[model samples]
Target: MKKFATITLMVFTLLIGCTPDANITSPDESTIKSQAQLIKLPALKSGLKIETNLTREKYINGYNGGSFIEQFEFQCVTGNVIINSQLNFPAGAFSGGKTITQTFNTETASLEFGPAMQFNIPVKYTLTVSGLDLTGINPETLDFVYVAQNGSITGVEYDSITMDVATGTLKVTNAKLNHFSRYGFVN
Candidate 1:
């Protein structure tokens, strides 16, 4: 009986010690760190929304310069996404001599860029058009010049505009103020 009791106690101790707890987690911290790797592009948060009026402060050449209003928005979760753009004169401005208006709506979970390239962001997302409209008196022409096309990962004079689509990494380059044209609004 004494020997049997000792054996039973030993078996019970082994069973209690070997049991695995459901709440116990692994001590390896790298696994969590690897998963925590998030896209850190600062431009992603700089300003998702950009709205400004185009001014006649500068002109491309001898042609009549047209002003424009622009807006930009950005966001990223796993990857990077961006919209780079350039805008021409508003439509119907020449006829009415009034401010031409353009409205853009993005309903997707992605980002959007306006006439100003400064707000270009890198993020991973989808773009859905919620609404888009252009209205003005004379209705001047408008164009989106691709200084850096969408998904382009190189040669941006500004670091902020450059971003990694896979890793969601971002770099903010210097501001490029002189790249846009004025009188070219005709085209």
Candidate 2:
């Protein structure tokens, strides 16, 4: 019986040794080549003539004691020029039915949420700005800022920002919005 148990343990060890490690992965040559190509791509220049528009709208029935949580993605895309913005409204965000308007200004790289009002719960807003010239700008020095009506800017705390140099896309995630206003990225 001891001999049989030893053989079984040896077999289990061999099987474990033969199994591939899930945590370790090597990229294929094709994937490496594609990554190289992406690295070699030219930087997007300024004045690319990108157009913008509102691409989506969603309505939720949160009025009259109804509770709902909804997320809406609004995109302005034109031939690779994309301004994607997402708003996640928490449950019981509004006391009544409300219409929110979003506007993106490409020239200043700013976004405006109209009907400036505070919510019962904070709404999360994420923005990804693409198809703009980001040359000579360091992504690490960027911050999400609130642009006031008088053009004054203030840095908004508690937001995460990331940038892709290859695509010239800057993204701000988890920006909590208690009130609607103009927001944008700044260095």
Candidate 3:
């Protein structure tokens, strides 16, 4: 399964690379933000099965902590188009904090922002998994990044989530570009 996922991501990246470098103007900030706001991400809907795992990290000074990874295997039937992607939870459950979702319409980019946390507080976050409804582009070529309130987190401001378009699984945790093959512009 791991090998298959690696191959699938490689293929997706190659597809993106093959696209001719056409002069495509990037969308404005306001436009992207507006589209992101217009779109609604339904709360993990009912009748859908969700699988989660909890991994613990033992701290030497008794600061031991853990992370909960939750994933949803479902389909988007309400929207005109359906995108398949996985959502990753870095911190854990959202018992308190804030959560926000943003999408770049023209670039077809979407992001989820979690609450801001201080030094003593641990934060929870949600990432757009495999399927993001980017209007026209195939879910396979869509890369993901989570932009959250800045403060005590390490790595890039936006967490890059990996999307295996073929298997419909999000493999990576933390913000790092998934790096995949481009499949060309959507018509």
Name the top lDDT candidate. 2
**Model 3 misplaced regions, further than 4 Å:** 1-30, 37-63, 71-135, 138-156, 170-172, 176-187
Candidate 3, after superposition: displacement of residue 116 in Å?
Answer: 8.6
By lDDT, the better pick of 1 and 2 is: 2
Please identify which of the two predictions, 1 or 3, would achieve the higher TM-score against the true structure: 3
- Which candidate, 2 or 3, would have the higher TM-score against the true structure? 2
Pairs that clash in candidate 2:
none
The lDDT-based order of candidates, best leading, equals: 2, 3, 1
lDDT of each: 0.29, 0.61, 0.33
State the lDDT at 182 in candidate 2: 82
* Per-residue lDDT of candidate 2, residues 26-127 (tens digit): 754333323221111122245544444232334543343232222222223222456677787777777766766776654456777866787787778887
Least lDDT summed over 10 consecutive residues: which range in candidate 1?
Answer: 123-132
Per-residue alpha-carbon lDDT of candidate 3 for residues 7-27, written as tens digits (9 for 90 to 100) = 999999888766765324775
lDDT of 1 by residue, 1-187 (tens): 9999999999998887667642245743333333321121223334456333222222221124344323344343322333223334423212223332233222321222323322122211111211121122112212111223333211222323332333332223232323321111101
Error of 3 at 133 (Å): 9.1
